[model samples]
Target chain A: MKAVGINGYGTIGKRVADAVSAQDDMKIVGVTKRTPNFEAKRAVELGYDIYMSAPDRENLFEEADIPVKGTINDLYDKVDVIVDCTPGGVGAKNMADYEKAGVKGIFQGGEKHDQIGRSFNSFSNFKESVGADFTRVVSCNTTGLCRTLNPIKELAGINKVRAVMVRRGADPGQVNKGPINSIVPNPPTVPSHHGPDVQTVMKGLKITTMAILVPTTLMHQHNLMVELDSSVSVDDVLDVLEKTPRVIPVEASSGLGSTAEIMEFAKDLGRPRGDLFEIAVWKESLNIVDNELFYMQAIHQESDVVPENVDAIRAMLEMETDPQKSIAKTNKNMGIIG
Target chain B: MKAVGINGYGTIGKRVADAVSAQDDMKIVGVTKRTPNFEAKRAVELGYDIYMSAPDRENLFEEADIPVKGTINDLYDKVDVIVDCTPGGVGAKNMADYEKAGVKGIFQGGEKHDQIGRSFNSFSNFKESVGADFTRVVSCNTTGLCRTLNPIKELAGINKVRAVMVRRGADPGQVNKGPINSIVPNPPTVPSHHGPDVQTVMKGLKITTMAILVPTTLMHQHNLMVELDSSVSVDDVLDVLEKTPRVIPVEASSGLGSTAEIMEFAKDLGRPRGDLFEIAVWKESLNIVDNELFYMQAIHQESDVVPENVDAIRAMLEMETDPQKSIAKTNKNMGIIG
Candidate 1:
């Protein structure tokens, strides 16, 4: 069994820590937080060792009566891999610490793709990450894109992909982020970074993406128009998507019409934190016009990548060399569905 | 001057009444309300005559100390045209009453296209509405689509159009309507009604639209991917959109990064109720990869159609035969700027 230490006890960090704990071949040795907030106290209650990210600010925890398992360096000493969930650029800054400690680092998508050298989505680049010392898990949106597009590309081949990503303005817990009552063309530019981000994982894919931020906190929705190499039936497209791991084909007929309903379904299914690790594709939205395939999918931003992080850890530690087997193990342990 | 009766003093109705009051060629003879709501009281304070839609419900208004200006029939008898602002489907139910009253009926987008026999977008079909007895102003989204696409079609000819409409979940005061925290694939079906609705105005235009409703009350944003008949420079495309009536090009650099800022900009500009009648297109989002043109535009759902309603009235009454002249008159009277 490999020991995993989660470096950041926030949204993605806390979830990854739980998922790693559930895996039979891996365990969360500890999780880190710079502040003695409610999440830090909750981590203590869950009996996970809490590591302080800021070595000099250890007193903040003592005053809040939240016990600490020494600083991040000490956690690194006990773990074989560190899953860094520190906000975006901060992960890049934390890279040196992981390097100095000689621990394999699994970074989140926020960091620059070049900084980590490899960008990963279990569905797209699992084999490429095996036995690597470090790899970055792409953001929720990109991971979602790769999971669906890579499968379709393998099935009928793709000439090009044009997607419009309607992203949520903020996560439920993120009170500061906004577009609060507006829809913003996030970068207000063509192929807004996401298309190029997807290229980081699935190389040589012809894709262009444009995104807008909406005043929603539930999930990001992507409307994809893929120009296939040849004509394909809607059933054939749906077949590939339904068979793909970590993708659930939700139909409007099932009353799972929107992201809200999907999230509610997750809660009903007893998923932790009402999280949906799978991408929910609207089966009713699948359509074919000659060579073009259009469909819509919802990405639960906070949890979709949590399972990806678990798979990345296994790949980096070489515990699971086969991509499919690793993905299966991660899914089974986390209770992820098709 | 045409005397206009605004039937249904709700969200669209109240705004249309105010807009009509501002126009020199039109005046709101009266507005109808079913009950003595706050809006009804506000309508009275505005010094406009208030008509009771439910004549039997007049006692409800009398008990609330609000005076009624006879029944809807009384207002219709005095008006040359009636701008039906009733909710969707509700307007269709009132069509027979309009026919009996012998008043030219101008319906909101909520009603069916066949019910009114013609759909009007001043920029797209004002001339077609001239001397007509009835014309339905397309919904805010359809009006917005026609304004931009028609201009572009005239400029470079559109081969096809694909749009993803990220719609607002509820109007500002519609606390009852929702997916309050979710992003919904409105119909969760390919080519949502919007595409067919647009076809009602810009006939023979190849287009497909998919809409997702998000938790917001400010505006609806459209991400349009238009395949042009031939290559066009970004400047040329921008020129066409910039010169279009009822369309304003906004940039992120100006801090109008999202709909919230745009709404705030409207408030700052002294627009009543902070409503944006013009579609705010993100100038920086305008880009062309060969013949495929991509851009994002925001439609203030509450008011974008207000000016369209005004123009439809002028057309049906033959107050202006030239579409351009009517559009200019409507824009100037309502302070609409590109």
Candidate 2:
């Protein structure tokens, strides 16, 4: 089994740690925490060997009576591949340590695309990262976009695309973040950063994106419009999306209406953490206007990329040559089924 | 001067009363209220007589010690034109009373297009409503779309259009309204009701719209993309929009970034009720991708249609023969000069 070390045990880090633990092909060696908070204690409760992210600040954990396995460097020495879930810029800073340990590094979407030189989405660009030294997972929104669009592009050949992302103001755990009573145009500009981020994985995709932060912590809703090279019926588009592994086609007729209702559905399914790893494409919202395909999908911001991260680990370590098999393994292990 | 009766003393009703009071060619005869609410008391305090909408329930006002002038019929009888601002379906129910009074009736956007048979946007269909018995002012979002698209349609013919409206969760005064922590797709459907409603006024204008309700009371932001018949540059589009009355172009560099800042700017300008009578289009967001023009504009949901209501009144009564002249007069009286 490949040994995986998760760097940073915060929102994404803890989830990645659990996802990696759930996989049969790999086991989490340890997880690092900067401070000895409740999550650090939970890591210990979950039988994870907690490492000090900042070795110099080890006293913080010691004072809180939390036992540390070792420093981050020690954890790196024991693992074959490390998923760097450290918040944005910090992962780039951890690059040298990864290089020194001679281990493959899989960075989260938060990092800049240039940091690892290769952006990854299993369905779109898995082969590009096979046995590579490092790869970066695109953000949740980009992963959500690519998962749906890449298949359609292959089927119909896209001419151009426009998407407006209604983003959650904050993650459920992020209590302090807000536009609590406002919808702020995130960049307040045309073709937001997400469009180019999708281009990083699925090269030369002609898409422009605009994002607005709404007062919600459940999920980000993407209203996507694509002009295709050929005409398509609503069923033709639905057939393609329904067959895609990680894209779940939900129907309003099923009484699953909004993101709120979808979240409740996830909880009803007994999903761990009530996390929805798949992009919930409202089947009712999917429609075809001539050669254009339009639909709105909800991306659970915290969990959509969790499965992608697992598949990336498989790609970087050459654990699975077939992306479909790797995706099946990750989804099955995470209890994601149609 | 034409005498006007506002047949609902609620959000839109009160704002229309103030706007009409400011106009040179109209006078507020009275306003109707269903109960002895604070707004009814405030209307009397402001020196405008209050009429009981349900005359049989006049005891409700008497018990609350608020005097009622007469029944809604009494107010309708004294007015030459009545602006029906009752909530949604209620306005349609008030239609027969208007017909019996032998007065021209103006309806708010909430009422269905078939209720009046003619929809009015001072810019797009002003002439259509001139000397007509009744005209319905389009909703705030539709009004915002028409104000910008109508000018662009006139300058460089529009081929097709798509818009995503990030709507506010509630009007600020709507204390109990919510989506408090969720971004609910208002309809979760393609080509929402706003698109068809726009066609009611700007006929044959091909457009598809999608909307989501965010947690905000300030304004609704629309991200619009239009395929024009001819190639146009950013400057070409901006020039047309800048020349359009009641569409104000705002720049991010000028420290007006989002709807929150724009609303604050309105208050800073000492606009009555901090109302923004114009659609604030982000000048920086106006860009052209070949034959397509893309931009985002903010619609102050409370008051963007206030000026439209005033101009619709002019069109139905032939108070101003020219649409531009009526628009200019309405904007000037409401202090909406650039």
Candidate 3:
């Protein structure tokens, strides 16, 4: 099994560790934390091969009730890949440490798109990340857009895309960051950074996005309108979307629910961490007037990038030429694919 | 039988004329027009008692081939109620003319909110206009909001309402107004008039509305997040909505379609003048995190308000009392309300 190491065992990191452990071809060799938090203590008690000392809590593992031992460098040496789940830009700035350790690394979505060698959404363009030394999992919005747009590109040649994204503010963990009662223009400027990021991933597609941040922690909803190169019906578009592996088309029959309901559905479906495809579409909202305009909603941001990190790790390991095929094989070996 | 006079022969007026003609208790006295338009000529040929000339074309009826002939004042005298399908503010200014002729009047939505004695939205508060002399129809956006809100109010008392109304620039007939590419803020300001108008008619419900106008002539889509007075589950909310009259709960299974599809569905259901209910909700979009927040999209204006005008006319004439009762009566009278 390819040994994997995770840095930053927070909510996302812990989930990533769990996802990696579930993969038959992968093993959680170690996880690093700067402090001995509840998650770190739990990871130690689970008997992981190594518990790398975070800079601040360098001696916590040795003082644990059931002592765990390892220096950060030794933990890095044992793993074939390390995932930096550090917050935002910290991952890119400190990526050199993982690179020098001779282990391939993955960066979180918080890092700028340019920081990583390749940016990826597992279902949209996983194959493109194969053999890359460092990959960045895109922010949730980009991941959601890729999942929605990839299917459209494959089936419908799009001429232009216009989107209005209603984004939720910081995750629950972040404190006092929003104008909770008002819908604020993110970046408080036209053509926000989130919009450009959408265009960057779907580089060939002519896409423009406008974002408004609402006070919510659950999920962002993208109201997308597209002008396709040719005429297509709503059924044709739904067919293409349904075929995309990672997207869960919010059905017409399902009564309306919140983002939490969507996430719950994702959990019940046995989706791996970061594999939540909560696309809630309003059928009446999709208008293909004549052959020119098509409307839809794509949801994404930080939380969605989790699965992309996992896919990037698999790609960097060079275990599968085709990422989907590799994932299928891995799942079969884990007895989860069937 | 009440003799109903149509003061304009535009799309709405013509439709109103047909609807009234079908009513057993209502008879078309005459239609007034500024020019000898095809609709006016058709109404004349159909053996109407008179064809009144608009102020500018008072002499046209004098030279008409058909026997039907009269001045605008003459037609006003014969009808018990006059339906003013004139453009915005025009009906308000001309209200005295109808009252002077001893006629009760129905004004279209374009009239200012306070100009007429009462504002009518058949299902929500038509009975309030039972004995009222003059009634103005509410705008389409307000009509859609009322329809959506009324059901929710019945289930859980709404303490506050926040809405983002995205409106289309112009209707299909207004094709001369092109360059429908940009999404412009409606009213280009906060505290939009549309919001307060809805609040006024909702019996002083605390509501704030923000609007964006796009370059499409289709229906408007409202992104509404309401704060209820009490907590309610999503299932309970859906159950309440599904049973609400005039508010058709569109399920995810119905698939996606445009405003036109919704209009077509209303038509197929034989909804009178297509004044039926429409609330296409994505179950995942609703969030009742606390006792407060609920998010949804209200139907845009055109398809919504136009039919509301028909209901307003019925309410003005005291043809029905309760909006649902009126809708049922009107539908049955029109051979559609089973």
DockQ of each: 0.78, 0.74, 0.02
lDDT of all the models against the reference? Answer: 0.89, 0.89, 0.64
Q: How many clashes in each candidate?
A: 2, 0, 22
- What level of docking quality does candidate 3 show? incorrect
- Candidate 3 residue lDDT tens string, A172-268: 5667775333333443222446656765566776665556555555567666656687777888887776665555566323632235555556567
Cα lDDT tens digits, model 3, B1-338, are 77888887775677667777777777787877766656667867675655554554555655755445567787876877888877777888879887787788888778886888688776567777776788877877788788778878878888877666766567656768632333333343334677778855778787766565444554566666577887788788877766654455553235322344455566676765464335554343455644654444436343445445556666666776667766665555555421
Instruction: Give a tens-digit lDDT track for model 2, residues B130-231.
Output: 899888999999999999999899888999999999999899988898777666777878879999999998899899998888778899999999999977
Off by over 4 Å in 2: none
Pick the lDDT winner: 1
After superposition, candidate 3 runs with Cα above 4 Å error: A45-53, A59-68, A267-284, A292-303, A327-338, B1-338
Which model scores highest in TM-score? Answer: 2
Candidate rank order under TM-score: 2, 1, 3
Residue B28 shift from truth in candidate 3, angstroms: 36
TM-score: model 3 vs. ground truth: 0.52
TM-score of chain A of 3: 0.86
Please tell me what DockQ candidate 2 reaches.
0.74
Q: Where does model 1 exceed 4 Å of error?
A: none
